[model samples]
Target: MNPASPIRIQGIHYTLPEKQVGLEQLSAEGRLLSTPETMRDFGFGDCRVSSVPATVLASATVKALLERHGVEPGEVGLLINASVLPTSSLVPRGEALAEFPSGESAHLGLFRFSSTRIQDELGLINARTVGLSELGCVSLSHAVWLAHAVMLMEDLKYAVCVNADVFPDGIKREVVYNVCSDSACAVLLSRNPEGMHLKRYHTLTRGYYWDPDGHQNELLAAYFPTGKRVLEKTFKESGLAREDIKLLVPHNVSLRSWEILSRFTGIPLEKIYTENIRPKGHSVAADNWINLKDVIDRGLVSKGDHVMMFSFGLGAHWGCSIVQV
Candidate 1:
């Protein structure tokens, strides 16, 4: 198994919560830790709040993707789950996880076994499930990388990588300068030699800033230098130049942060897709892959496009992926 061999991106699908909650609404609902005006100052807007369990959304999206692509659950050899909430957020399709504060305390008991439950829900019985966490927002991109590695090393035929989560309370919504959205993204990777390829991936973690709040200033200070390093290193590994990238498919962070990163990395702002930020807010698990789906769905990339996806997690982890599509 050659390291450079292609692991085709077979499909990418995601599900957003049905109900949209405005920034002002959170304050009115008594869910915001800060004032509405304070949240709005960061470019926060309407983000989805699902009345249903996170697992229902994730499983439904995965099922539809498999069916539409004529893929069977049994054929999926690996299930790499990138969801890392503190509790089990999956519930009935129409029931809001946010409505249950009592059940949340019980989620801790079931948290370790969430991947098995998600596997059963999606009927991916043949899939050997693997969980990823502690990377915060970069977990999904790392899941994609793991999909590639597992397929190459273990000779797996297919992997379904899912990144999904929605907060049970509006109080859990905001992360620094970004508003968190509830959503899930499912991406399929197949052992194909000539499809969208995961060309290069680089992940780095600074454990010192593990406490995001205590080190807010430090996190802000290190962000630009760290992002530039990760992006450049990933590009170098992929045998591409930063300026040659077709697009910067970001993890739907704030536009201001994206602007800073664009100048720091020398990738034009126009090449970065930010249209989804307003409607999509930031889903820690789903951002990069969801943005990738939006880009491909909107016909923004050609077959040979060189795209870069980068993400930062609160636990001081930065991960980026360079792909050939």
Candidate 2:
């Protein structure tokens, strides 16, 4: 897994549904808290959605990837869904745990409603579903890492990684509104290099030190460190550093989170490629893939550009990948 090895990204597609939810509108719905103080603190403007169910975004994204790549759906060996909104209540405890700083009382109803819609619309079959719900902004990147791993182990010819979310309506809590948006992105992955090759990956996570008095450290411990550790190990195994990376894509949850991660990684803030947060706000799990597609579409990463991706969610789950153009 040499970082220098080239991985080609053949096709990337994303969907931003027509429906848009502004901060002002959410404020009216009592779902988004829009006090001046809160707005200044969180740096949230608005979010997006589709009139259709969240799962439709997933299906649409998958279809878009297939159409763009001119590949058939049956050719896909796996379908990995990285979403913040689950359509099914069957298994909500694992990755889809509900814990908001604003508490769950005000938001649970909306959550259940959207989750039901997601379950109803995404009657996806054939491909195994790797459900990642609560991972929030980092879900898509984690899916990408999983896609790469699957390519390494299985006889899979192609993998479809889909990320979609619809910021729940009737969310009366502003704290929950600003950073959440509705969007979907689909990426087609293959072992063959007729497209992009996945050269290497690095992930690192460290939490919960042995200390009796510092209970506050447990807060940071909420994030899963195993995936993060694997990312770092992969980087070391590949023998490369940030300097060799031409572009960096991170899960941009907020302005502050982006700044903190930039400081922690020592990657210049300017080198990071962020989505149109001011325009589209945060698209939850779809952020990473959408940003990757933006990079590809804007011609920001030319062929042979060394792109690095880092993503993590509340569980402190972190994943990183290095792909060569």
Candidate 3:
């Protein structure tokens, strides 16, 4: 595999749960720690809630992507699960201690890997399964970068990166005033250069803000500056100027935050895709991919058009990736 050969995104698909919950309802149900007015001010209207397990949503997206692209199960050489939540946990962490006094259930939960389950269910017998976590919302970006590297090294045919996340029942849906939705997204990468071409990626991890809950204000303070630096570095690596970016595939955080970032980075706010912010809210690692897919579907971009993807994981990881459509 030549290093110069581009790894392309052959296809992308995402699935959200059928249930949609509004901010008012979430606050009324105590699922939100913030007031409904605050969330609305942040540009959040409604978010999808999942009635099924995270793995089920993940598998659904992958299955849909493969079927839509006519990709065979045996053709996928790598399966990467980038979901932030536990896929196979039989019980919540709080209940595990009480239900399994001997810790047998805990051990079983650890052994029940979500990646393998998706592989088995999808009959991806030739694919090697890997799970990535702790990067928070940046997990999917890292997973895609890993797949690109591994596929190049192993000379693999196809790699599938899947990410799904859902807040547990009775858990808070609001995180620092941003509402979250349950969603799963799958991106198919191949040597075939028919889709978006993978260009360059940059990631920065600030270990000092490792404790997200403890340092919420500090994390918010560092987001824009760190994100600007990341975007500049990513564009420099891609050999493209900021003006070359046709669109900014942003993570569904907040419209106001994106406006601030756009102003700071000298990228116009119109270049950032924000249509999904109010309707879909944020879906952790799946936001960028989902937005990218929609952008392409709407014919907002053309062949050879460059798009920049950026996200800040709550674990203090900042990532930026550039791709050409």
Top candidate, metric lDDT: 3
Off by over 4 Å in 1: 1-3, 33-41, 88-108
TM-score of each: 0.91, 0.74, 0.94
Highest TM-score scorer: 3
TM-score of decoy 1:
0.91
- Against the reference, the lDDT scores of all candidates come to 0.79, 0.60, 0.85
What is the descending TM-score order?
3, 1, 2
Model 3, residue pairs in steric clash: none
Clash pairs, candidate 1, are 51-95, 51-96, 53-91, 303-325
Q: Which ten contiguous residues of candidate 1 have the minimum total lDDT?
A: 87-96
Candidate 2 yields a Cα-based lDDT of 0.60
Residue-wise C-alpha lDDT for candidate 2, range 1-325, written one tens digit per residue: 5333223355778888766766666666666545634653555666665565566666666776777777765566677777754542122222332323235554553344322343334433345556656554567766777776776567567777777765444543333324566677877777556666577655543344223136335634443344345545656765767687788876555665556556665667788885466566777666766777788789988777777776655444466777775
RMSD value for candidate 2: 6.9
lDDT of 3: 0.85
Candidate 3: residue 121 Cα off by (Å): 0.7
